[model samples]
Target chain A: MRIVALAGGIGGARFLRGLLAVTPSSEITVIGNTGDDISLYGLRVCPDLDTVMYTLGGGINEEQGWGRQKESYVVKEELAAYGVEPQWFGLGDRDFATHIVRTQMIDAGYPLSAVTEALCARWEPGVRLIPMSDDRTETHVVISDEQGRRAVHFQEWWVRLRASVPAEQIILVGADEAKPAPGVLQAIADADVVILPPSNPVVSIGTILQIKGIREALEAKTVVGVSPIVGGAPVRGMADACLTAIGVDTTAQAVLELYGSPLMDGWLVAEEDAGTALDGVLVEARPLIMHDVESAGAIAQAALDLATEIAARRGTAPQGEDAR
Target chain B: MRIVALAGGIGGARFLRGLLAVTPSSEITVIGNTGDDISLYGLRVCPDLDTVMYTLGGGINEEQGWGRQKESYVVKEELAAYGVEPQWFGLGDRDFATHIVRTQMIDAGYPLSAVTEALCARWEPGVRLIPMSDDRTETHVVISDEQGRRAVHFQEWWVRLRASVPAEQIILVGADEAKPAPGVLQAIADADVVILPPSNPVVSIGTILQIKGIREALEAKTVVGVSPIVGGAPVRGMADACLTAIGVDTTAQAVLELYGSPLMDGWLVAEEDAGTALDGVLVEARPLIMHDVESAGAIAQAALDLATEIAARRGTAPQGEDAR
Candidate 1:
């Protein structure tokens, strides 16, 4: 079936790898979150996009779930020697080439969407990967420490600080003005089902929804979301910290309520959170640990099965087998 | 003695290492040629400035005469994988950091001179390293191949083509509007003796002279030049190809004549070209091969001695000892 998946970094990328394993490559379109994109040392680094690309293209470091396989840190060490700042964000030698090509293209006046497509040409990431928006949309987190309150870039908050400080607020700085990247709205319109992979609800899928028209498009479609919050904690990443920033409890039902029934047609919670109920959405409990590719594939299959069931209850023809 | 030296890339950097061996670190100011500077993958690569810095800072690959020692090519290999052009120019992993820092500073609105100074802060190359100009000044060589006569970037001709195709003309593209970088003119004016190292006379020292006021400043000073040419051939590099393009014979006397009596106060030729003469300029013969640091130092000493003799003949007090 034609599917559109919204993704963030490692967690999201890993989920997509599972989704790709079970689904036909030609049917998947990934809308990668660029809110965490940062210009490091004058090169545009789209961590989420690169993670998805590398993971699917067989270049990802499987153990780390991010960066290139067989990566070298010679470039990082040299930058440190020069006393360049932001030393915490490690960009490997092989990974640096991706940013260099991307930055060079962007500097030559191509928009982020075009640059993303150009970069994907090399990896052939299997699925069509489009950024959430062509425009700059940075997710900044407001944190208060002993020093005082300040807003830092999402990467700084995530990678540098490790989300240690409690986030007072999560702001999508340019989301209000962002237009969905070319092919994003069309992909949503054409898809049989839209999947929200186990990416960050606050910064990844949530940020993609913040872009104008994306949420409205999903509201008109059959959407199934896998709970990034497996039980009372995140399946991966600092999603608990993020959910807390938005004043949401760290539970599958609480997250489903946050997305709301109007947007989510089906919600897949983990077996641990079994019997959790949502008012209008179809809630199913499934194994969501995603310990391996096979487990991830099963999770993806469960979400698709739930979407098919939802379609049948509404007396609409399911596009699953026929579309495939 | 207080000395100001004009330099190019490998050969010039090697000569400076020798000059530094014989001279006090605090007394030398190096005006490095920036005409060979190129922006690759959006990062500024200053070949001449980097060679000088790396050589003096103990980071240079002695065997190659350029780039960092024990460098990795992971970045370059990755760039090629992405199908980025200009693959022949090798920028090592360690060297990429310098460009990254420089490009970052430039993008943040710092002038090239300021960026150069900031980069030098990390290297502590000892001598004050100043680029010939803060403005963009590229050397382009006019060559005719099967594709017909066209001017290409100096690097394309020198590196990719290996200077095999005869250059009909050599043009310093932006030199007419270029101003000498901060401290270049002041260094020349405040010097005891200005030395021209055994750098490429055409592209290296010649490009610096093409800057608006540098040649005039040197004309008013006690200038001494060591011949890059020895026994009717360049000691290193493709200086002969460059000289032939400009219609100058690859001989010490011809090169001295090209600089002319008005600009050059003293000239040092190799023992093989001992009888080579230039009217109105003091000519001295010496063993000019810079096989090692010790030999380079001896050559530097000979240039200073020639400057002393020229000062004594003109009944002017030499600034060498007093400035030292």
Candidate 2:
């Protein structure tokens, strides 16, 4: 089946790996969130994109679920020694090469999509990967602390602050101006099913949806979402902090409602959230944790099966045997 | 003494270390060559300035006579893995940090002089280090081979090709439009004596002289130079190839003539070239091999003494007991 997956960082990447195990990687097109992208030490760093690339390409630090395996912080330490700022974000020696190549290409006038393609040439990450948008769209967070009320880059709030301070608001700064990257709309249009992995509802998947035409394109497809919230908390990362910022309850039910029936045709939540319901959407309860590739693959299979059931119920199923 | 020195990489940096040991580092201001500077992987890499900084700041790999001590090549390997070009240039992980910081500063519209000063703050190289020009100036060498007669970056010819091919011509691109960096001319004007270490005359010291008004300013002061050639060969590095490219012989006498009487008041040659002489310039022969700091210090002391003798004979010695 032609599959399209919307991804964030570690959580989404891990889910995609599981998706690949259960499905042909050649059929997958991953639309990665770029709202978390930031310019650090003058190098363009797409943390989410790189995480997906590294994780799928077999270069990820497996224990950490992000960054390159056998990564060295020599460059980071040296940068700090030179007293360059944003010391909280860890960029390893191997990882810096990606940003360097990317920044060079972007400065040379290539779009972000083209640069991502060039980087993927080295990783050969199985599935076709495209960013949410070609234009710059940074996520910024508004908060109040000892420094008083201020807005900081999403990375400054997330990676550096560890989402400790309550975010008053989370904003995608340039989403209104950003167009979906070249293949984004086409991928959704061609896909038999669109999968939203267990990624942050407010930032990762939500940020991509904010991009012009992306949400509209996905809405026309049979979409199934795997809940990031399991047992009333994020399976990984600080998604709860992001959810709280948007005044959304930290539960699978709240996130499913946030995505709504207009976009999601099917929703898969943890067994504990079996009571969660949304009109015009097929809701299924299962074990939502991605403990390993096998477990994650089972979750992906369930999401795909739900998508099939939803497509059949709507009488919009493609004639292909796989889709039917 | 308010001393000024024109420097390249390796030889110049090492000599400055000895000069610092002999005299107060605060008294020395170094005008480093920017000809070897190149933008690699979108980062500004200044070999000469960094050499001077690393050598003096105790961060240099003493054995290699360039780059950082205990450097790792993880970044370079990763870049090569990405199929990035110019893999021949070995930039280590530790060294990459310096370039990244410099590139970022330059992108933010800081001049090379300002960036150099900022980098030096971390190295604390003791002597004030400044590039020969704030404006970009790259040394290009014309050579004939499979690529035909085309000008390649001096680094490409030197580092990648190892200067195995004969250079037909050497050009300093942007020299005509370049001006001496801030404090370069003023440093020469305020100097008691200007020292030319055993740096490459063709690319290093010669490239700096191409900057407008620099040579003229130095000509008005008491100037001394240490010959890079001893026993008709360069003390270190590939200075002979560079000298030949400019149609100058690889000998102490030839380099002395290249600098000429207009710029040189005192020229220190090795004991092997004792008879090397020129009218209107004091030429002193000494044991010029810088095997260690002490030996290099002795050579520096000789150059200073020659400057003092020239100043006394010209009846223009500064009114101080040291000058007399």
Candidate 3:
């Protein structure tokens, strides 16, 4: 099946790994979120893109679920010694190479989409990975503290602050001007099913949707979302904090309702959230806890099965497949 | 005594360390060569300036005579894994931090000289360190092989080729349009004596002289130079290859003659070249091998004594001191 997956960072990357186990990686096209993209020490860093790439390419640190395995922090230590700012972000030595190659390519007049393709040439990240947009679309979080009210970069708010302060607002700066990177609309248009991995709803997938034409394209597709929130709590990261910033409660049903029926054809929640109902959407309760690759693969398979069911109801089941 | 020293990379850095031991660092201003500066992976690498900084700041690898004391090559290895080009150049993880800070500062609109000062603030290298020019002045070397006669970056010739190929010509690509960095001319004009460290004459000190008005400034002052060549060979590095490229022989006398009486007020050669003579310039023969810090200090002291002698002869001896 031709599948398009929307991804954020660790959770999305892990889910994609599971997705690949159940489906042919060659048939997958991952539309990675670039809202979390940051430039550290003049090197462009796409944390979400790299996490997906490394996890699928067998270079990711399994324990951390982010960064490269056997990574060294000598570069970070030296950067600290020089007293460069934003010291809270952890950029390991092995991870620095990805950014260096990426920044070099971008500086050499290649757009980020082209650079991503070039880098993927080395990693061979199983599935095709494309950034949401080549243009800048930074996610800024507004907060009020002793430092007063101001919008900080998403990384500073998320990584540095650990999302401690309540976010007053989440702004998708430059999204209005952003054009979906080349092949993004085509990927969505050509896909048999569009999967939203257990990535952040408000910041990750939501930020990508903010880009012009992305949400419109998704609304026309059979979209199935795996809830990052299970039993009113995020499985990983600080998605609850982000959800709260948008005035959404930390519940699978609340998140599904946030995406709304127009966009989602099917919603997969955990068994704990069974009996949840949503208007104009196929709601299925399953075991959503991704404790291992096997469990994650089972969740991915369930989502695919739901997509097939939704497509069958619309008389648009995937080619060469019998609807169950 | 107030002093201004011209330097290149390893040799110059080591010489400055000895100079620091002999003279109060507060009295010395080092004008470092920027000819060897190159951008790798979009980050500016200032080899000569960093050498001077690290060596004096007690972070230099004394054994290798360059880079950090305890360097790691994780970044380089990772870059290689990404299949980035120019793998021949060794940029350790610790060294990458310096370039990152410098590149960031430069991108933020700070000139290279200003960035150098900012970096030095962290190193606290004692002596004021300044780049020879704020503008880009890359050294390109013309070489011939199967590729025919073509100019390559100085680093490609030095590090990749090991200067194994005979250089047909050496060019300072942007020297004509370059301006001496702020404080460089002022440091020379106000100095009691200017010392030329055992840096490569053709690419290091020579490239600095190519900057407009720098040579003229040195000619008007009591300038003393220690020969980088001893026993008809370079004390260290590939100074001979560079000297030969400019049609100068690898001998102390030949190098002194290349500088000529117009620029050299005094020249210090090795004891092996005791009979080296130059008209209208004081030529002193001393043990020029920098075996260790003490030997380096003694050589620095000898250069200072020769400068004082020349100043006394010209009735320009520094105030409050009789020539020894």
User: Model 3 over residues A244-298: C-alpha lDDT tens digits?
Assistant: 9999999998999899879999999999998777887999998898988888888
Give the interface RMSD of candidate 1: 0.6
Q: What lDDT does candidate 1 reach at residue A15?
A: 85
B1-324: candidate 1 lDDT, tens digit per residue: 688999999988888888888876438899999999999998999999999999999999999999999999999999999999879999999999999999999999999999999989988988999999999999999999999989999999999999999999999998889999888889889988999998999999999999999999999999999999999999998999999999999999899988887899999999999998877789999899989999998888888888888888898856645332
Each model's Cα RMSD: 1.3, 1.3, 1.6
Worst-scoring 10-residue span by lDDT in model 2 chain A:
A315-324
Question: Which segments of model 3 are wrong by more than 4 Å?
Answer: A320-324, B320-324
Which consecutive 10 residues in model 2 chain B have the weakest lDDT in total? B315-324
TM-score of each: 0.98, 0.98, 0.97
After aligning candidate 1 to the native by TM-score, how far in Å is the CA of A39 from where it should be? 1.3
lDDT of 2 by residue, B1-324 (tens): 788999999999889888888885337899999999999999999999999999999999999988999999999999999999989999999999999999999999999999999999998988999999999999999999996789999999999999999999999999999999999999999999999999999999999999999999999998899999999999999999999988999999999999998899999999999999999889998899999999988899888889888877877774334443
In candidate 1, what are the lDDT values of residues A1-324, reduced to their tens digit? 789899998988888888888876438999999999999999999999999999888899999989999999999999998899889999999999999999999999999989988888989988999999999989999999877999999889898999999999999998878999999999999998989988888899889989999999999999999998876999878999999999999898888888887899999998899887877789898788988888888888888888888898898855756332
For residues B148-233, write the lDDT of model 3, one tens digit per residue: 88999999999999999999999999988999999999999998888999899899989988999899999988889999999999
Q: Which sequence of candidate numbers ranks them by lDDT, best first?
A: 2, 1, 3
Task: Give the residue spans of candidate 2 off by over 4 A.
Answer: A316-324, B319-324
